[model samples]
Target chain A: MKPLYVIKIGGNVIDNSENLYHFLKDFTALDGYKILVHGGGKIATQISEQLGIEAKLVDGRRITDIETLRVVTMVYAGLINKNIVAQLQRFGTNAIGLTGADGNFIKAVKRPVKTIDYGFVGDLNNSSVNANNISNLMEAGFTPVFCALTHDGDGQMLNTNADTIASALAVALAKHYDTTLIYCFEKKGVLKDINDEDSLIREINPLRYEELKKEHIIHSGMLPKLDNAFTAIACGVKAVVIGKSDELGKLGNNEPFGTRLSKSNIS
Target chain B: MKPLYVIKIGGNVIDNSENLYHFLKDFTALDGYKILVHGGGKIATQISEQLGIEAKLVDGRRITDIETLRVVTMVYAGLINKNIVAQLQRFGTNAIGLTGADGNFIKAVKRPVKTIDYGFVGDLNNSSVNANNISNLMEAGFTPVFCALTHDGDGQMLNTNADTIASALAVALAKHYDTTLIYCFEKKGVLKDINDEDSLIREINPLRYEELKKEHIIHSGMLPKLDNAFTAIACGVKAVVIGKSDELGKLGNNEPFGTRLSKSNIS
Candidate 1:
């Protein structure tokens, strides 16, 4: 199978223009089939504030009301996504920016109203992604750039998590390619000590992952990401990397830049 | 050659939800290859007002300052474009929303300043449309839904006229397909009498169009549209149609819906 990379970038890279420029340059220079998944940054929140839509939160999780969704749809899918596509094109990458609604690439269901109504938020499952259509697009020579938005397969657009989208895409596309999912954030990797960047755990397999969890060395903030990485590895993705966005260039040269997780240590 | 429809709809169809829904359903019901170009409606202006970005006009024409450009990008490319794609997807159209930046499908030079600088507006020429790439996307089975936005090759998004985009696409794609360009607006067609709907000019060849102009029958508001339609006809578009959006379904059944323009009356 041909190698493919599914990379996700959060606010740390997107919020800063200089970082985004360097990140995109590295991204375009990397060889092979790749897809970019981007999360909404401070701009969405700032725009929401300007539009006079108060931020709603339940149990520390942000809510997506109708007005808030519109603002995000404009910022994420419209402003940020198109600008990124334009920049990629300037760098000679044939990029196509998309929301899940476009091409029906990912159809997510609205979260059910239980203890709280998430208000236009979408929750995905294994079958939520249209891998065949996405693969067809990549095979046609256009790189796909996805924003953190999905549709209900009805006429409604829903706010979604960018990280989850990246993992789902990797798992789905793994059937056709040697897929590696990379989550680029502010950290160097999963550090053994939270404050020490040099204490980066080079690699973790299922056994070592169990030990790390038992010892509670990973912080709460990193637990969900690690758990998701393991889930993706279990679903056939070749590897999952957690690292800093600035070090993307290192991957092309096979230098150690981040923590890599796979099914087994020997592999 | 295969038949392709390049359709443009303005504020009349987009500003109203009910009208938009019906129009999209009609659009999806039409057979053969089709592309939709949409204009930025009143919502952009509304959002601009809400954002406290004052609208600037020079010589009665709107100026696209940097702030205005951002708002329109959000509204057109992000909000309206994505919603239309989602709706079309719900109708099983397999639509992909796009701006000129996506796939480098269209590249425009920022309008040269002469009398007034239209800050971020884009102007297109014959070579602006990437015909082969667009054809490839269409041949790949994804219908394109474009908003009135284009990008300079250097990575700036620009405001563009949707009607011109539609005509440009029709002219460029004509080399590969038998293309018909349709403009859906508030009127039924180019009326012989401005106040009378019964005075529809069903067909207007070049000679008759010249006569209509000499006789002062065509109003100033209709002149630019007619000039563009004729230019498209001269450029080898199979035909151009001016009609009401609600009457779109009639075209699928070979029923007359709009005034048709062609090289000759017999065509």
Candidate 2:
């Protein structure tokens, strides 16, 4: 067995704590075999308002100012990151919260998009994941928790989206320990339709995904998730799945659940 | 006049919703800002214990196992981040939660500590911060809340502490918009005697701090906080102040708040 799994979660799963708790229980049961990454854009926006601080975005990417970045670090790293680690510990699993800012486990460059000022948003260009560090944690029987934030060579907290984060992280871990990628969110699977809950897309291919996206059948957010799935596959990840977080272990099996995404060249 | 303030919060002060609620109330009253950075560590350790996870740490660092990481991502970046942001929004603060993994804002390099495997922990090395993201957010009147977890180019979560995070972020923002670094925590101030609260070392210079440290008057954790504060000053940060979270804006006025650190070369 590869003994490693890469999981990415979105804001919806986070809002559902009971589901999250149960998911944690299940996750720990597979101890020393998984790395968890998450996103918190919606939450950060909410907190910014509370502080009477407005949130700024240029070209769809968050503009991380001083006060906003402060709330982000405090909420994501301090409160949220620790909360997940503590809950896992409570369930007899050792977990540590981390960001890309530490130990250079991951390296990113600033995204210089045309016309739009992405600002602190980082583009996935370089990474230097140390397997020794990950192996040591696994050897010590611990899990590493992560949020969607990165530090540039300059002293700034760059913004990254969950799908992009998941894809990048999956590539790192996949190459590190021959792992599979599981991207979890609100929907059990990616739906072909944006409005119809029953139109759950059973499976998808990179080409077919493009067609759906081009046709506007699937909305914008899911397109990024799908794109990430393909990126993971291209970067040598064993496989990629999009679904609800609680069903990872069960779905990641040979007869996996959720929406499976494969490279057109593969299947 | 840039209308920005970087408030760095500690995990100790925001362990619960009630504590955070009050903190948000006061934070909202302050002038409009663009960023907020937060920290949370103790709760993660606490919950890890409740779950029967061993919570392994070698040389003050936790191993990044899969299970632990998952719980951490869910709790910190996902759950806690959103919860706090949502609470702030409820308090009328428009806050958004962010993790380092989301944006490659804070990039790092792996610490090459000989013989010791600090799994997933990155050294504070990167300085390429896109203050434009923050500035844009500020201009848009949005608060960008950030957590410490960042994604490498390859997308792995690096373990980062909040102190350096605050300092680095402060430097980024201050340089971007010429702002202040407000570090808030439970401690009244940096103390010469851990046992004697009144022995608060009102202030200290780098040379004198080194002497006090050699005399064994400083704790290991405090060493890093002070070091980071100094780092910010050197990096062009206007000021750094430590105070309680509830009274974040009151520091530098009359309150006996937390310690303030500056560059030794300044004098």
Best by TM-score: 1
Residues B86-126, candidate 2: write the lDDT tens digits: 55555555565655543335556555668776666655654
Candidate 2 local lDDT, A185-248, one digit each (tens): 7777877665665777767777777777788887766756666677678778877877777776
Off by over 4 Å in 1: none
Q: In lDDT terms, which candidate is top? A: 1
Clashes of 1: 0
**What is the DockQ for all candidates, taken in turn?**
0.91, 0.04
- Pairs that clash in candidate 1: none
Worst lDDT run of 10 residues, candidate 2 chain A, spans A98-107
| Error at A167, model 1, angstroms | 0.7
Candidate 1 structure quality by residue, lDDT tens digits, B62-106 = 899999999999999999999999999999999999999998999
